[model samples]
Each structure stands twice: as structure tokens, then as C-alpha cells.
Target chain A: MEFDKGLIGGSTVLLILSLLEETDRYGYEIIRELESRSDRAFQLKEGTLYPILHKLENDGYVESYKAKGERGRDRKYYKITRNGKRQLAKEKEQWEKFSMSVNKVIGGELYATD
Target chain B: MPLTKVDKFLEDVLSHIKFPFVKDDISFELESHILEKIDYYMEQGYDSEKAEELSIRDMGDAKEIGILLNKQHNPFLGWLLKITNGMMIFFIILNIYFAGIPFISSLFSKNPINTIPKEDIVYKIDINDDKIKKIQITLNNGETFTETEFYEDLFLFAWEVDNEEQGRYFNNIKGYDSNNNVIFQDEY
Candidate 1:
């Protein structure tokens, strides 16, 4: 299926904020988490992920610093900011409301009453 | 084959990206991720070439991705970016030129030269109907006046006087031309 660029771009930041809610993660770790958690349904490409990460950093939604990895390679680690957490909560509420309405339409859960 | 294919794919992708950003740490990270994807494909029994092709295909359009990356970090894109930054520098230089027009305009106006520091220079103006026939000017120091006159719709005249106490010469001038220009100066 072709991906909608606009939807993917906007949602990528929200997805980042949501993932950082669980714990601090590096770039690869976050991508891996999204893949596993979505049951391999959302296959995010590498090129897509880094740009969103950079944008979030530029927007002050996240911050990064260099840290030594398990294999001794220096890796950039990102952590959510207070602002990021607040934004995540707001986005989560909106997503829930949106998905609920969408499910009603697509999931056949909504019916007309006589 | 996966490595070879991956290398070619990266070259294509990186070429779409302008210099500097393509070689940044972020670029390295993305490159490693693509290699990892190639490795995963290879694990699934695909040859190196197939694995690399699959990985590149999964990555989608690199040009589109590069544009997104540029938009994120470049800060200067779009028309507003060019106008504020590129044209802003041009506009600042233009402002200096625009600022001089009024100063030049004031030199020709009928108003007395209010900008000059008054020391010991005295200025006089005589008007008859629409024509200015003469202008009298005096300096406190022992010096004389020099005059220049030109004809226009009205006669234009100007003179300069030297002051002793101020130890500087002052230009006390007047014009009768509709279009004003400083036609007279006296150093004596």
C-alpha cells in the first residue's frame, strides 16, 4: 500500500513522543520497538525515522546526547522532555478519539436506530 | 551482493542529498540501518543482490526522504526563507541608499540649513515676489563672502563665509531654482 506522506510525517513525531513515553531509546531501538509492537504492520524505513528525530530535537520535543553503547560504539540517545510528555498525552487523547470514530465507521460498530 | 547493492543504493540516495548532511552522523546511522535490513533479508535465504534490492525497495523513495531531511535541518527553504535571509541582506544595503535621499532632498529645500552646527556664521535671505535677487551672509572672523548665481524659473544664488572663532568655514547658501542644487561654495 502506498503511504500518505503528509499523514506519515505528522504521525511520526507523535509516534516518537509516544515511544519515548515508555523509556529512553536510541534511533534503532525506537524503530525496532515500533515494528515489534505493531506486529510488523508498520515498517518504518531508516530514512524516514532520522529526519523526524532531528525535527523533534529542533522543535524541543526531545533531546539527545552521546552515550557509550553495549558494544562500545558511541550512540546518540534521546529522552523525552517535559514538553514532549505533555504533547504526547494530548496527542494520545486525540488519537484515541480519532480511532474510536474511525472504528465506528470502518469496524461496523455503528448502527442506525429505528 | 547485499553489500554491493546496498552500496549502490546508498550512493543513489546520498547523491540526492546535497553535500555535508549526506556525510553527517545521521547519514551514517541510516546507512547502518539499511545494512541491517539487508542482513535481515539475507537471513531469509535471499541472495545478497535480492536482499539489497528488497531493502532498498522497502526504504521507499530516497529523494522524497532527502527533501524531508533538508526541510528539517536546513532552516532556509521556501520563499519566505529566501526573502528574509537572501533578500534581507540586499534590503539592508538598500535602506542606506534610501536614507540618503532625504538628506539630499533637504539640501535643496527652502528651509534654512538647520542641520549645520551654528558657530559664528550669520545668514540672510531676501525674496521679491517669486525671484531671489540676493543673499547676504557674514562671518564673525575677518573674512569675505563668495557668490554664485544661476537662472531658473527664479534666480538661484549661494555664498560661503569663513568664521574666525569657530576656526572653520561655514556655507550659508540659498537657491531660487525650482529644482534645487548646491551651486555655490566659498572656502575664503
Candidate 2:
């Protein structure tokens, strides 16, 4: 079943940024990476993928450059920036807290810390 | 077909995008994705044709994808472009408003100047009581009536209305009482 897009949409940025932090990757490479890692759960559209890349580039979160690929052809690759790492860390911390709260609520141990 | 799957996909995405400069990047990236997917499917022992078909099918709906892409690409740039378009439209209207009226008004109200000199004029006025204020008059064949300077007793004006030639000239005009009111007007 398709994951609720609303739930997944916000995480896409975090995921892309975190992955790029691992290594510089091309568009298709990132798609393959995300898919394989998520076990085909997050099927991303290429059309949906590009604007995010462009936005990250625009925001200085990531940058793209052309380099010769293994096929001896030029391919565009995106690398995460210092700012992206900072943002990714912030998002991860927020997600951990959010997920912990969600897990507690689901496990019937919903408790609030004052 | 020029309507090849890749071509159609690019058309769908680019149509929603407002920025032209970014089109090349989008085209190259998306085209590369489809090509990569085709390569992957072919690696799994599929024929080239089937690989291409699967790759295209895997891309999902172009319109929906375009909408999502637009949602990301257009926030700042779209609002910026819209404001630019709005300002351009506003300035065009403003230019027409400020510049157009006088030009159009001039076209219709293009009256030939009155060649009559100041010296060769005589207006006889018969009045003794009220002072003359400003006189509004239209010369014979003039397009519009306008105010002329005539402080009575110091200056004089005569309105000559011609029936055959279509009407009025203020050559010799006159008269005012103490309070700049019309004292006498004798039209000849």
C-alpha cells in the first residue's frame, strides 16, 4: 500500500539530505538508493524528484555539477553542503522526538513530561 | 513520434514550470532518469522496447508529477514572476493613462490657431453700471470655448455672430464696474 503522502512528503527532504551526506550522487542514483534502502516502499517519481533537487540547489542545501560517469558519459551529481548537514541534524532530532512520542502513544504509554 | 514518452513527460513538467532557465536542468535530469530506468530494466534481461515501456509506466502520472514539481519550484520564483507581471501590467496602464489622454484629446481638439492680431481689433461696448468679469467665448469655427482676458474699461471685446459663416469672434471686448462685474455688453 502507498504510504500516506502527507506523512512521507515532509520526510523526503530529510531523507534526500541525509543520503547526500553519505556521498555525492546523481538524480537516478539517489532514486535507486532511496528505493533500495526503503525496500521499494518509497517509490518516487522522477518528475517529483527533480524540483526538490532544484530547490535544494536554489537554497544552497545542495549543489550539482557535471562529471564523467562510469559509462564514460557526463552525468550531473549533487553533493550536500555544510548548511544541509546542519539542517539534516536538526530535522533528525525533531523526528526522533516526534517518533518517540508517536511510539509511546501507540504503545498505550502516552505520558507527558512537564 | 515527437510525442514520444520522454518528450511528452518533459512537455507536461515544463508546461507547469515558470522558470525558463531551469528547463534545461529539468529536461536533462528527467530524461536521464528515464534512460537510467531503461538501462536497469534491460539489465534484468528485458528487451529494449519493454524496458522503455516499463520505465515510462514507472514514472506515474505526468500531470500529478508536474503539480508536485510545480509546488516545489514555484514558491519564490512564481510569486516573483507574478509580481513582475503585475507591475508590468500596472505600468502599461499607467503609461496609457498619463500619456494617452493628452495625445487623444489633442487629436480631436486640434484647432487652427487664431491668426488675428491684437492691434487690428475693435469692440464697442455699451455699458455703464456693472463691472466685467472673465468672458468665456468660442471664436467662429473654434472647436471649444475658452476663457480670455478682458478687464472691462481697460480692455474691450465684441462678439460678432455670423449666421452664414457659422459664428462668434471676440476681437473687441470690454467693460467692468468697480467690483469686476459686467457693467455693459454691446454685441456688434
Candidate 3:
């Protein structure tokens, strides 16, 4: 199936904010979460992940603070803000409405006589 | 081969990005992330060359991502930066007005200053008061002078005599008694 870059790019922010809402995550961990949650179907590149994370940070939807992990490498971890949580709720509602509408149109074909 | 591929990918991505205020450490972390992704791809049975290309291709547009990252991290910090830059420029101009112009002008001042003149010259005297009395003079190689009453202040009397230039030579001046009292006398 072909992927719509714009749609994917647009949804990426909401998807990230949704994930971050559950808990704070570092860059690598967030990428790992997306892949593992999607069952390896959604493979995010580092470039894609960092930029989205950066944008979310710039938009005031997320914040980052540094912590030194076991490897002694300082990791920048991201957390969702109140605004980000609110944005996620709105996006979730829209997605549900959209999917329900699409399902009605698409799923109805399964029941209809061919 | 993997390292070379990562290097090539880094070069390609770095060329397109303009991280105006981003620190080097952040850039390094980004590189590490890319390298890790490359390693993951390689582990998944992709060859080094293919893995490198695939990783970069999956990364999407660097510029777009960089812009988003900037927004997420700072949130309108660009505007803050612009305002600060304007303030910095204004301060530089203000500094020139306050210090630079005065410093340069003082360098070429018309009244040049030197330290030696202050210490080398001396002698300041003040004459508060002087009085003169009636005077008589006889001219000779040495002058004879007489005064009816002596003045308490002598500097003023000398000044008056000098101004008149009447005595051929000023010397041997004496005070005289006007009635019964000799007020003063001087020889000069």
C-alpha cells in the first residue's frame, strides 16, 4: 500500500503526543515504542523521530530535560504538557469520528450484495 | 562498511540541515540515533549499503524535521532570538555613543595635556593692600626720596611708585612727620 507522506507527517505529531501522554520517553525509546507497538509495521527513522520530537517541543506540546543513564550518555527525555494532553484528546476524537465514518462507508460494502 | 555507510548518511543529512541555535551535543545525539537505526536495519538482514540508503530515505525531509524540532524545543524562541538580536545591535550603537566616540575625540583634543608644566613653574604672590604718602625725590646716581606719612602696606606703595616712574632711581626713601607723628618709613 502506498503511504501518504502528508497524512503520515501530520498524524505523527498526534501519535507522538498520545504516546508521550502515557509516560516520559527519550528519543530512542519513543522510536522503539512506535515500532514495537505497531508490531514492527511502523519503522521510524531517527531523522523523522528527532524532527517530530523537536517540533512538538517547539510547539509547547512537549518538554525535554536531560538525564544521565547507565551508559553515562546524557539522554534528553520528553514529556507531554497540559496543552499537549488537550491536543491529543481533540485529535483522538477527530480520528474516531473519521474512522467511524470511513468504516460505515467501507464496511457497508461487506454486508451489501455484490 | 557500516561505519562508512553511516558517515555517508551523516554527510548527506548534515548538508541539508541548518541548525541555527542547536548545540553540537544535540547534533551528536542525532548522529548516534541515525547510526543506531542503521545498525538495526543491518541486523534485520539488510546489507550495509542498502541499510544506509533505506535509513536515510526513511528519515524524510531534514529541513522540515529540523524546523519542527526547533519549534518543539523552544516554542517561539526564534522570535525571542530576533528581538534579542535587535537589542544587541541597539546596545552596540549605544556603546559607541557613550564610550567609543568620546575616546576617539579625546585622542585628537586641541588642548593637548602634559605633566611637566604642572610641576616646573612656581611663585604666586598676593598683595592685599598698600597705601602711599606724599613723596619727595632728589635725582643722582642714587635717588633720595621722602614720604610724609608711611603706609602700612608697602607693596601698593611700590606699585604706585613704579606706575608714576617719577623717581630717577628708586632708593633710600624715608617717612616724614606730617604734624607730630611719623606714620611710616621705607628705603627702597
TM-score of chain A of each: 0.83, 0.89, 0.84
DockQ per candidate, 2 decimals: 0.30, 0.31, 0.32
Model 3 achieves a DockQ score of: 0.32
Cα displacement (angstroms), candidate 3, residue A68, comes to 2.2
Clash count list over all predictions: 2, 18, 10
A2-101 per-residue lDDT for model 1 (tens digits): 4565766556777889899778888777878877876765676766787788778877889988786775656678899998988888887877677677
Candidate 2 iRMS, in Å? Answer: 2.0
Per-candidate RMSD vs. true structure?
A: 13.6, 17.1, 20.2
State interface RMSD in Å for all models.
2.0, 2.0, 2.7
TM-score of 3: 0.52
> Can you write out model 2's per-residue Cα lDDT over A1-114, one digit (the tens) per residue?
567787777888899998999999998888888898998888876557777887788789998899988877678999999998988999888877877788787774454332
Per TM-score, the best of the predicted structures is 2
Task: Give the lDDT of residue A32 in candidate 2.
Answer: 87
List TM-scores for all candidates, in order.
0.52, 0.58, 0.52
* Best model number under DockQ: 3
Off by more than 4 A, model 1: A1-10, A68-74, A103-114, B1-4, B18-22, B45-47, B75-188
State the RMSD for candidate 1: 13.6
